[model samples]
Target: MPWKELRPMSQKLEFVEKAIVPGANVSALCRDFGISRQTAHKWLRRYRDQGYLGLVEKSRRPASSPLATAEDVVVSIIELRSKHASWGPQKIAGVLARRLGPEAPSPTTVARVLRRLGKVKRRRPAARIWSVDGRPRIEVKASNDLWTIDFKGWWRALNGDKCEPLTVRDAFSRRVLAVALVPATTAAHVRRVLELLFRKHGLPSAIQSDNGSPFICSRSRGGLTVLSAWLVSLGIRIVRSRPGHPQDNGGHERMHRDLSELQLSPARSRRAQQRQCDRWMLDFNHVRPHDALGGKTPAELYRNSTRRSLSPLLPTYPPEWLTRRANKAGYVRINGDQVFVATALARQLIGLRQESELRWSARFFDVDLGMIEILPIDHAYLGGTVMETVTTVRPSERARERIPVSA
Candidate 1:
């Protein structure tokens, strides 16, 4: 036969009732109720002092906790969290340490507090899958070694106006150099913004961008666009991310994710939206702490490049190499014939080196254009009286090769 379960309160009441009887043995009642002598005495004392209500269970919690977080400190954490809703416990803890000094709680404590207060939401762990693309990523050792630029996808403002923000960031320091609102995605508009950035922050060794309009032309040789060509002229190496792979620039994409999370509601106007972006950028650079940067703000690690922005942005070639400026129609005169280069490279200097007797290699700065083949054309139309010079240009197979360090 199975034993019937007894409620704690009912058992205590029965034991107390049996013990209260005149000449009842309390030790016998304690053993019968399967309770210790001290417990039986405690229950009997409470019963005598306060009748049947005392038989009920009482709380075991202490009246106070000495190591509990202070009300003021908790208020400060909550306030900071309320201000930057997108920040995690680590970032919040960083700000707290800055504000509260030695009294600041650790990230774990902050996480506990936030979780207890229902401010922190549990997120699923992301899969740690490695993606490989054969191309090597540009190594960033200093502030201006590499800069990543991209346009955040456009969204409609509250007033129904489109808002597209151009973001430029230093790869090493993770500092956002600029967040400008361009009127269009044209090369000219982007160039104007970049010119200002170059003047302010100086030139980076390389600039990375996706293969999109204003950055690259898919049909063009080496995916060079007008902006990229100008960048090449300034002696900056162009790094391109693989098509359809945003993970190639994961850090920049994560920043965009933060921006999206913080700025959920669209502003009233483009100007207002820009002002919001400016505020967000200021906070992102100065206030928000990055886990990848050891809980330090980007502004703390970022420094302007030593390479200054100067006029007459022309690339210097070796003394042995021959140089020629392409005409406005993107044609360069090789020997006696005009060969078409790139429209993006119009008016840019083209370096030529003789590879063989009939074949000559053409390069724009460090980028190889192609092999320029000089062919003798016998004109039958003019009864072979005049010899016509024909130039045949083929796209260089090595055009998409890795950029040189000197570039």
Candidate 2:
């Protein structure tokens, strides 16, 4: 018979029966059985002591595993993993130790228990090298000093309606201020959500966002849309992450990852999704432990901003800056010379400050609207001079390195 087909119990039984025979040649029996002399002696001893049952296979497991994780600790780890399925062993261990004292299992123990329970999922290493840019770093002095906002990619709800979520997080404390599901990505919807957040949590010193609709306009002046211009008017500094550089707002992106994991499946309706998002925001701020925050929840570090929100009003510039109103065509007329300012600023007051004898800088409120230069109307009898803004539009570079907003 092939060695692969041999059964350990059957082989041991045959060997023990033959060895028990009187005057049996044990060495020849060992050679026929293809087993070592030590193995033959062990089976013979077991058979003499406990008979046929002793010749059967025996357990190789140790009698006691002193270093193994305790049953209660393993159960606790699995329970925590069930709550925060995305959290790894280190975070789970940290939380358990903080709550259950030093007797809690180590991170490695927790990992082993998770593996035994089939709760671990291995992820392949990304082929793309992780890179970060180091520019436009903003200092955070206190809570509400900086806030990062973005839209999680939209998905269809069970009702076949598209649900787009807008998330706003405090950069300093990693507090999630808002997570609202809206029907569209329009400025009005975003503005309403921000206004609610501002009234509740107060206004942040600065708001950071990517160059996208409602936040920026490439064709508009300073890439400022109406919503952004309103923010500038509210005395809030606007900071835009470089185009195509998501790491510029790394903290916000990380939060989006967590949110994506929570939203693995969409809800049936807009109301249901909003309710679910609200509950997640609560748990994220109050319960979830952040590894970067030294195992502290965001609510522990976050505080209400002292810089309270006020009714937004038009901005006023210094008296030296000449004030001119943009006409129906969004043009500022200087001695009958029409210069295009910005279409968004139509019928709005614009401040003009002469940078030089031939050049002038136009601004709406405090936002700059580029420079205009004077050129004489050639071969005209009236000799009226023409003033026009110089335009040199170039595609924005998207590969620029951006420093992490939180780090």
On TM-score, the candidate that comes out on top is 1
Clashes by residue pair, model 1: none
| lDDT tens digits by residue: candidate 1, 1-407 | 11146777778878888888999998887777778899999999999898888877889989999879989999998999999999999999999899999999999989989999999888855422112234547878999999999999888778987888999999999999888888888999999999999999999999988878899776564567788998987889988888788888888998888778435888998889999999999999999999999999999999998899656477777887778898896777777566666788889888888888767877777775657676655443443244444454454222211111111
User: Residue by residue across 1-407, what tens digits does model 2's lDDT show?
Assistant: 33356787778877778889999988988888888899999999988899888887879999999888888888899889999999999999999999889798889989888998899998854322111233447899778999998999877778977778999999989999988887788989999999898889889989999888888776566677778877877778888887788988999998888888545878898788888889899999999999988999999999988767566656686887888888765677755556665666666778887777656777766566666665544332322432233332213221111111111
CA lDDT scores, all candidates in order: 0.80, 0.77
Error of 2 at 52 (Å): 99
The window of 10 residues in a row where model 1 has the poorest summed lDDT is: 398-407
TM-score of each: 0.60, 0.58
Give the distance in Å from residue 338's predicted Cα in candidate 1 to where it truly belongs: 0.5
lDDT score for residue 146 of model 1: 94
RMSD of each: 26.9, 25.7
